[model samples]
Target: MTSVTARTEREVTRGRTRRSLVRRETWISAVVLLLPAVVLLLLLRIIPTVTAMAEAVPLGGERSPWSNFAYIFSDPSFLNSVWVTLLFSVIVNPIQIALALALAVLLTKHIPAVGLWRTFILLPIAVPQAVSAIIWLVMLRPDGPLNGLASAIGLPTVPWLTEPGWALISIVIVCSWVGVGYWMTFLVTGIKEIPSSLYEASALDGANGWRQFWSITLPGLRRPLLFVLVADTVSNFLVFAPVRILTQGGPQGGTDLLMHNISERAYTLGDTQAASAATLVLVAIVIVVVTIQFRMLPGKED
Candidate 1:
């Protein structure tokens, strides 16, 4: 009996030793696989952010270390850019999300050639934003195809990229055209993940389409919707290519978003310090907005 007990103990010891070696090997493999991505993120994102923050600080000779920030706040152009960016965010985010959600629902239904339709919608995403902006630039010209079509339809000509108000609206249109399809793809994935059994069960209980959407679809989509909202808000806030290529901050700074404003200050006016300060402000705004979104749309604990 004693010999049997010793044999059992030895077997247990061997099992644990083998398990420990396997666990160590797994960790080493994980680190090796992740190392390249970690290095790239540090080089691309962290280093640039640190450099921007360092550049934003005023030199020792200044009356205050926050001179750059003060200057930016005092500037009317910067203030206008902030207001414009806020307005753009408010308008563009909802439009993109709503359209994307609608398309996701429609495309996910039992429709013919759904994959082809999805590809057509997502084709814009394959095109670079700068190129898309340039294409829209021509399309929005006073004598361009859009206005020509308007004339043919007996409608008045619209100053798409020429006027301040219309320029902002034109930017919104261009952005939405590209963003809606991209966002829809994510929502489609989210919708697909929801179990079909829920729909079937709800149908048996006589729950209609709208009821099922309200009860199951929305609840199932909570996490993906939250992600889409946060990501869309951030991307809209960082909008520059469309504004730069189409309007160049526009006829009277009407479409001068914060990113374009920063570029103008840094590249056009040679104010790197102010640009860096504005970059920090933009980062702060994104952080605050994302925090609020997380609080408002808290994900369910698993």
Candidate 2:
């Protein structure tokens, strides 16, 4: 009896050892599979960012980093560019999110030709941003179709791209039009992920559509909404192409964004150090905004 018991104990110990070995092998395999992505991120993103930060620290030669940063701060125009970027991010991000949410809610319902509507909405995203900006620029021209329609209705032609006040507004309108559909896609996906049973329960409780959305849909969508908020803020802050192709930060620098200013300084003025410094400042602003967003997000304990 004692000998039999000893043999059974040995077998159980061996099985445990095998299970341990299998777990280790699985963990190692996962790490190996993830290695390529980790390496790519380091090579493409981390290394370049570190290099940029290093380049931003001047070595006391021509265009010293300190002098470059000082120049940006000292110039009233550059300071205005910073303010413009902040204003754009603040205004565009929330408005885009709200509009996208509204559109997503509308399209996700039992509407007719839903697929066609979604396709049309998302078609703008398929077009290159630069191309879209150019198309809008043409449409907003003083003698373009929009103005022609306005004139036919006895309304004066508004200088969409030529006036300082209207220039920024025109850029914002184009940016929102191009971006809202893309953002709506994310919200639609988020909304669809919600369980149908929850909606049924809310209906049984005599809850209206808006109340159900506020309680059920919004809670389930918190994470995705947070993600969209951060991403939109980053994208808006780095806005450049529209300003570059549409207005060239013109109409007296009304549409001058930080990225446009940086590009002009780096490529046109040949001020690499200054551009690097400006880029660093942009990065810092993004970090701060993201941090604040994360901190303010609900479910912090979780």
Candidate 3:
């Protein structure tokens, strides 16, 4: 009986040892798998941000450690760029998300040739933004295809890229054209994941399309819509390609977004310090905006 008890104890010990070995191996494997991504994140994102902060610091002879910030804040062009970037964000983010949601809802129906239509919408995403801007540049010219079509339809040929108001609007249009489809793709996926029974049940209760959308679709799409909102906001704030290729900051400073202003400061004006400062400012603004979005959006915990 004592030998039997000892044998049982020995087997339990062996099992625990095996379990411990398996756990250790699992931990090591997880570390190995995660190392590459951690290294890349540190190298690509964290290091560059730290370098920008370092470069934004004042020189030895400066009045304060914030001289770069002071310099940019005092400049009217920089102030204008800040305002313009904010305005652009305000205009573009909502328009993109709204149109994206609209298209997502429309396309999720049992419409014929839905795949072909989706391809046409998402085609712009496959094209590079700079290339897309160039295409828009030609089309937006005074006597280009857009204007010719307007004339053929007996509408006035609007100065798309020339006037200040229209130049900013043109930037918004170009950005929306690229962004809406991309955002819609995510929304469509979220919509599809919603249980079909919920829609059917809602319909049986006499809910129409709009009512069903509000009760079923919108609630189901909360997470993806939040993601799209935050990402679209950040992308619009960083808009530079269209502004650069089409307007070059424009007839006035209408489309002079912060990124373009930072590039101009660093390269055109040879003020790397100011550009770095502006970059930090842009980062701070994005952080604040994203934080607000997180708080506002309902999450799983909510």
For all predicted structures, in order, the TM-scores are 0.88, 0.84, 0.89
lDDT of candidates 1 onward, in order: 0.93, 0.88, 0.93
Candidate 3: where are CA atoms >4 Å away?
1-36, 59-62
Candidate 3 lDDT, tens digit per residue, 1-302? 99999999999999999999999999999999999999999999999988899899855864788988988999999999999999888888888998999999999999999989998998898899999999999999998999999999999999999999999999999998988999999999999999999999888899999999898999999999999999889888888899899999978898899999999999999989889999999999999999998998877776
Q: All candidates: CA RMSD in angstroms? A: 3.5, 3.8, 2.7
Q: For model 3, how many clashes?
A: 0
After best superposition, candidate 1 residue 49: deviation in angstroms? 1.5
- Pairs that collide in candidate 3 are none
Q: By TM-score, who's the top model here?
A: 3
Tell me the TM-score of model 3. 0.89
What would the per-residue lDDT of candidate 2 be over residues 21-65, giving only the tens digit for each residue? 999999999999999999999999999888777777867577655
Sort by lDDT, best first.
1, 3, 2
How would you encode candidate 1's per-residue C-alpha lDDT over 1-302 as one tens digit per residue?
99999999999999999999999999999999999999999999999999898889856764688888989999999999999999999899999999999899899999999999999999998899999999999999998999999999999999998889899999999999999999999999999999999999999999998898899988898988998999999999999899989989988999999999999999999999899999999999999989999998866786
Q: After superposition, how far is residue 237 of candidate 1 from its true place, in Å?
A: 1.0
